[model samples]
Target: MATSGGVDVGAAVIDCGSFLIRGGLAGEDSPRALVPSAIGTRSGKNDVLGHSLWGLPELVDQVVDVYDPMAGLQAIPKWDVMKKVVDHVLSKHLMVSSKETPLILVEPSYMWGVNGRAAAAELVFEGMGLKSFFIARGPVMAAFSAGRSTSLVVDVGHQGAFATAVFEGYALEKSKQTSVLGGRALSDYTYQVANEKAGQNGIRARYELPSMSGATTEKESKAEGSNGVVDSTAAVSKDTAGSEEKEKPKDGSQDVEMEVKEEAVPAAPPGEVSKVKPTTVEAPPPAPGAVVPKEGVAKTFSLDSKKAFYRMQIVHDLKQSALSIREIIETPDPEANGGGPAQTATAAAVVAGSKVKREPRPTVYTLPDGTELDMGQEICERIPESLFDPRLLSDSKIPGIESARSLHRLAYEAASACDIDVRRELFGGLVLSGGCSLFPGVAERFQREVAAITPQMFKLRMVSPSLRQDRASAPWVGGSILGSLGTFQQMWMSKQEYDEHGAMGINRKCP
Candidate 1:
C-alpha cells in the first residue's frame, strides 16, 4: 500500500522472523516490503546502504556485510541491530512514521515468555516510541492466515520448525514442540556436503560468514567439514556455545507453562531512503589486522545465494526421505467392500499381479557461478532421511533441537496432546506454514505418515497454502488481517496503558 508522509497513518503489520521481515499496511494484500532480518554495516560507521541486501551482490560495494541479530532459537539478542532493522522498515521502506502508526508484530511461538515478549514490547513502545502495539504468536498467526481458527500449525521457518496446536485462535502452549532442523540446519548441512565434495576434488571453498565480515575487524569462521584454516586477520568465532539450546520441556513431557484463558482482553487503543547513498563510502585504508578483503583483490568465496539453493534441494530431499519411510496403505473402495463389479475387477488385477511403473525425478539447480548441479533421486531422497531417522546421519545431533522429532510424530503428538474434544479438530485442521512447508510432497508425506499412526476412528486432513500463496509470509498476512479488523484495535496495549503498567503488563493485556 502506497502512503504519503503523513500523521496517523494506517496500522502497519510486521512479521519479524529470524530470517526475513515482511511488513505492510494492515489492509494490504501482501507486505509491501520484504527484507532480510539482517543489518549491513561498515567499520567506523553503522551506515548500511540498503535496508535489505540478502542476495544483491551487485548492489554491494565497499567492505559491506550483513549480520542477523537473531541467529538461533534466541530471537532478537542484539537490541541495537534489531532496532536499526526495524527503524529502516518503518521510516524508509514503509514511508510512514512508526511512532504514529499502530503496529502488529508476529513473534515466533517458541519465544513466548517474559523475556521475549516483554523485551519486544519495550522495544516497540519505549524504544520505537510507538503508541500502540499487539503481539501475536507465529504459529497462531499462521493458522489464522490459513483461514482457520483452530489448527495444528506445523511451521518450518528459518530458525527452526515447530508444531503448535491452536484451538479457537488460542495457542496450546504445551503442545508446541520445535526442532532445530530448519532452514539454517539445512544450509549448514548443504555447506558440509559442498565442503566434502570440494575436499574430494582438492579444492578450497571458503564461505563468507554473513554476520562476521565487513563491520568487524576480524572474520569469524564456523565452517563444518571444510579445513579449519585460521586466518591471521580473523578473530575467534563470536558465536556463543549453546546458542541453539532450546528450552524444551523435560523428557518430551507435555506441560503447559501458561493456561489458555477464554476471555477478551480490553482493547487499549491503536530507512536508507536514497539510491545515491553511496553503496561504499570513502574510507581510510584498512589497518594492519583488518579483516576486510584488500581493495581490487579478487577472492574466490561462495556466496550465500548459492548456499540457499542447496538448502532448497535439501528441503526437497527431506520431504522425499520422510515420505519414503512410510508404507502406502490402500483402502478398499465402497464397491469393493461389497460383492460388486469393482471387487471382481480388483480380484482380476490382483490375479494379474501387475506392477506400477515409476521413474526417478532428478532436481537440477544452476549455481550463481553459472554451473549446473543435478542431484539424483537417490541423493535427494537421502538428505531428509535424517529428520525422521536420525540414526541415518552420522552427526545426528542438531543445534537448538536437542531431541528431534519426525514431522509425522510432531503433528501426531501435537494433536494427541490437545483436549479430547479438540483432538479431531486439531487432526482435521493440520496447517502447514513457513519456507520448508513449500517443498513439494511435504504435505502429502505428512498426511500419509499421520494417517498411518492415527486411530481408525479418526480421519486425517492436512491443510497447506496454495502454490500461489505466500507461505513464507503467512504469519505477516495473518497479522495484516488481524490488525485491519475493527475489533482488533481494542486488543492493542496502548502507549497510555504501557506508561501505567510497563512491560510486565504485556502478558495481561496481549495474552
Candidate 2:
C-alpha cells in the first residue's frame, strides 16, 4: 500500500486511446509502468464484463482469465474495461494499491465538462483505493519538459493531431482559441488526395495506414515514410497484378506514356515503379473497365501529360494556400476580417515547364534519415490543384493546418496578443504543446517564418518534444516536481476530507 510519507507512488497519464501509468514503492524507487489503450477480447466468449461466473464450475478458472472488462466501448463507455485494466496492471506489478494505495492520474482538457468523467473517476477510485488524486491535461505536462514559460504545444498522435497554446501555465478557453487545427486535418487532407489519385483509373486498392490506428508505433516521417503511411489500397491480389501488366501495352516501351485523369491512376501498381515520374498522357479519363497503363503503354493513343501536370499544379495550390491560412489563424487579431489575393495565390501556384501549367511543391515528408516519402505527396498534390473546396479535394484550407500552403505573404491586423517577444538571455525559449504541432516541419519551419516576420533585432528558436514522449506530459512534468517535495498540506486534499465535504471540496482545494 502507498503512503504519503513513504516512497510509494502511483501516477498515470491517459490519452484517448492509452494510459501510461507509472508506479514506485518508495522515494528511492523508480516507476515501472506501461500504457496499452486497446482492449482486445475473444469473440462470443462474452459481450460484457463482471457478468458473473461466480458459481459456474466450468467458469471458475475462466473468471480469473478474463483480461479487459471495458473491452467493447463501441456501444458503451465500458467503464468495466477500465476496471479490468487496473486489476490486470496491479496483478502484473504485484502491488496491493488497488484497495489501499493512492493514485494521481491525468486526462485531456475536454473531459472536464463531461458527466461521464465524474462517474468514471469515482468508480476508478472506489475500485482501486479512495486515496487518489487526478491531474488531467497531458499536453501541458509534455510541454513541461521543454522548460519554457510560454509556448505553443502540438500533440500529434494516432487518432488525431491536437494543438494548444498555453500562456503562463494556464490552459486557455477554446473560445479564446480557434479549433479545427491538428492531425485529423492532416490525415483528412492526405486521405482525400490519396483517394482521388488511386480512384483515377479503375484499379481499386487498400490504403496501408489504418484508420484511427498507428499513433505510436508508426515510423518517424515528420509525416509519411514507409512506417508513417501505407497504401493498403495496393493490397493487390495475384489477379490484379496480371491485369495491370496486361493492361500496360505488353511491349516494354518508355516512348509510350499512357495518360489518365488524377482519378485514373491506380495505387502503386507493382511493376517497374520509378520515383513518381511526371507524365503528360491524359487519355480522356479512361472508361470504366477500360484497362490502361497507369504510366505508359506499348501501343495506342499518347496520354495527355497536361492533365497530369494540371493535377500536380492543384496539389501545389492546396499545400501553399493551406499553409498560409493556418499561419493567419494561428496569429489572428480581433479586428481581422479575412484573407486576400496573395493568400489565394498560395494555393493556386503550380509547377512550370510541363504542358499543363501547375503549382510547384516542396519535397514531401521524409523518413528519419531523410528519404522521400515515396507514398503519394506528389500525386496527392496534383489532385488539389484543380479541385475547389466542397469537392473533397477542394482545399478551402481556412481551418486547416490541416490544409497546405507557403510562408510568403504581406499582411497584418493587430499583431497576436500572445506573441511575447523574447531576448535570448531571457525568454527566447518557446515551449510547444497541444495536438496539432505534431506535423513534421512545423517547429523548424515556423522558426524560419517567425524570424522573417519579426523584427530582425530579435533572434528566435523553436523546439519539438523528445520523440515518443506525450505532449500531455508537460503538465505531468510540473506535477512530478510538485509531487517530490515536503509533505505539503497545501497542494493536495485528503480523501477523508472528501468523505466529509464531497467532490466540490476536492475541486476547491486544487482549484
lDDT computed for candidate 1: 0.53
What is every candidate's alpha-carbon RMSD to the true fold? Answer: 14.9, 18.5
Q: lDDT by residue for model 2 over 283-346, one digit each (tens)? A: 1122222223322121111232222212322232233323221112123222221221111111
lDDT of each residue in 325-358, candidate 1, tens digit only: 2222344444332322112112221122223334
Which 10 successive residues of model 2 have the least lDDT summed?
250-259
Candidate 1 Cα RMSD (Å): 14.9
TM-score of each: 0.69, 0.46
lDDT of each: 0.53, 0.33
Error of 1 at 94 (Å): 1.7
**Backbone atom clashes (below 3 Å) for every candidate:** 3, 85
